[model samples]
Target: MSNNPIPIVDFAPFLDGSAKQQTADQLLGSFKSYGFLYLTNFGISNEEVQEMFDLSKRFFALPHESKMLAPYPEARTHHRGYSFPGREKLPDAGDVAEMPLPSVKETFDIGREDDDSMLNVWPPDHILPGFKELCLAFYWKCHEVEKNILRALALGFGLEEEWLVRHHRMPDNNLRLQHYPSIPLESVLTKKVARISNHTDYASLTVLFQDNVGGLEAEDPNEPGRYLAVSPIPNSVVVNAADFLRRWSNDVIRSPMHGVRAPQDMVTEDGMLPDRYSIPYFCAADFSTVVDTIPGTWSADYPKKYEPMSVGKYMLKRLADGY
Candidate 1:
């Protein structure tokens, strides 16, 4: 068996309109193979990425008492705020009730804007002016890019390019920020770091923009229990279809289960520091969109056995259970 490299798609091809058919064919190959692709030449600037990280560090630096304002389980919109470990359980595995507890990670969430209005949890103004605006601007930037990428995905699947984009629940989507700080050196001395156990994302699609630190790993199909590193490349967004998309595609594409490791896996580089910051945009369809089978893809298509649901309802269960 060949360990072929996953195709890296350049959005420029489509943007330039120089070779659309070729671009679409490449897109389709990526969709069918791993359902994940490295999207480069997409124009998301490095300075912009650095600014996003700098802001995240500032937020995380606020005293724990200050950061507590947006605590999880209490945030109604499930949008903003910091999440301590154990607050989100993994929903797709044996009931979240049965899954092992989550890791020691803190996250801040944001969402898309609509009608010039985007929902957010203010961190009491005098403390941080334009903080929300700065973060949200980055959120919106990723939001539009996500839609464009989805348009490419639809083309890859031989479906109308806008088919999935139109189906997305506007601005209700998530722009989640996470900080997997270097486990304290004392903890390393104590062997107490509790990293995120293995898991896959729950949204329809995820646009992950990670810095140079390389702890993210996916299960090696040929070597169970072992993991293959998802090394981050600068100036590119890591894209993957999620569980909802897998179901919607009738399992034609699967949600790849990935997890992180402790610092031992670290490969030192000039750009990487001990701190690992991640901001992923989870794009989803309206909760009401049913995950049904595609009719023309296979020889014997069967009915969708799953029940219909709105994305919010499903996410609530996942979060409450701890995803």
Candidate 2:
């Protein structure tokens, strides 16, 4: 219903030893409140982000037949490759009947290439000269950033700095390139389809590089039915806590529901909206890692809300439920 009041924090201090406690405090505060924030000076260059977006555009521009080379469901098992529009439906987190429309976005997913069990699906090198290399590079850079953020978050949670880093040694992270195609206003009003339906991310943390055509909205903690628009900030990555982390903290931190919808002013003279692109790096703990409440985060008054489970099992179940 309004713009987000999430704080923008400079991450440069976290890299150096100076003012680290202050940085941790800011992170903790933001996590406790909105569960989202804009992170700047996190070290990935702007040019690199732009290049990744360019490659994503090219990939999405491929002919339908070509893009379908690596389709969903089949790729869903491997957790990689293309997903056409309408291929995904974000089932209401609370009730399925609340919003039955399928999400109206196309996506391409990739993971660490070194993983033998879940290999990345890439376009032929000849078709997109350096696509694979650039994507992999961006993915690794995001992974490093996630690690550093986790280090700061560990301190915020009153734990050893390396507590989270040690548990995420073999992360099951994914790099998802999403494209929400233009649509008519009438269609949106009639069908009630969202670019992406409202839901909390299944990972521990999500680092997103969104374009200026913003539609991202985060639910307000203090007001039900009220949402806050999260506009894109130049040279910044939007970071948010996810369900896994909330579970790990026994709800000490929140993983608020977020979604995408076309902004009112997005319509052009022809009544067609501009395509929106976003690349979100889902930072997850290792598949085999069993997630439980952190030491200082739980008490007898507030018992652990989640049963212990492996990250892999939880992620697969969530993915299956989403489709």
Candidate 3:
């Protein structure tokens, strides 16, 4: 067994079909124990990942006015555009209607091309040539990898491999690019705000790719209030279970709470923390699909812990609560 609390799983075995069952068994254990893992060999090349990062840096470097051309909607439900730092609020100290922390990060959220419920916001070709085309292509590529993981999860649950994949057929997911710029170390030390406050995701699952400047941490399962740093491994993606999956599994797989904090050792001589960047793909289910405990996940020993709920309703409520 690895000394690291979170295991690293190679996805090649699952895709090749040679050791699919063995791969699924390891995945099942990770989800049940840590609710998170580092996944490698799931497709997508390092060059492609770096290109996305380069695009993000260029986009964020633009003048504030120019970047704001594609504005975030006033309605939280319509989440497809650029959000300036501190624009989003998330619960950190408590679970309440009003979240207490204003994250010190800027974000650009992209949804599926065919999502008719809300229009996508993007910079014109003149501003960034081929930006939309590249992002869209990358979005679908990530989805292909997502489907494979869903299939693995289904197989682990003793259901058809396509079971979870079918539920997420609709294009209702989010691809977010985040930039946490350098900030004074005093602000972090005083607990005035965070790069991203401690909170669990609202989606079914999240696949995260982060740069070398690492500060992401998962709440230690063995210690309630403490956290364990999740260092960045080159070319690895961090995968974690989220709220909707927790509900669907009837608490069989809990969503791990996580957040990012500035590393003290990396503090600059000028008392500033270095900038950090990350890309997270939030995978969700079809809006109208009703989420209930998966088959074989509950019984007399563990009855269904949640009521049936539609993904749309659940997502809206969670988004509203965060704001």
| Superposition error at 213 for model 2 (Å) | 0.4
Clashes of 3: 0
Q: Which one is best on TM-score?
A: 3
> Candidate 1 lDDT, tens digit per residue, 1-323?
02436557887887577866677677656656666677887657878888998888888888887777766536443555667754654432323454464466788887654522334555765566677898889987887777777677677677887877877746457787788765553443342444565677777888888877767766655566666667787688888778777766767775777766654546345322277888888887765555445434444355554555566677655545554
Native-vs-model 1 lDDT? Answer: 0.67
Q: Lowest lDDT 10-mer window, candidate 3?
A: 90-99
Cα-based lDDT for every prediction: 0.67, 0.85, 0.87
Residue-wise C-alpha lDDT for candidate 2, range 102-218, written one tens digit per residue: 788999998988898787777677776888788888988998999999889899888899999987888689999999998876776565676776789997999999999998988
Q: Rank the candidates by TM-score, best first.
A: 3, 2, 1
TM per candidate comes to 0.83, 0.95, 0.96
Compared with the true structure, model 1 gives a TM-score of 0.83
Which clashing pairs does model 3 show? Answer: none
Higher-TM-score candidate of 1 and 3: 3
Q: Clashing pairs in model 2?
A: 1-227
Q: Candidate 3: lDDT over CA atoms? A: 0.87
lDDT (Cα, tens digit) per residue for candidate 3, span 80-155: 8899998887777434554477889999989887788867899877988888888888888889989999999998
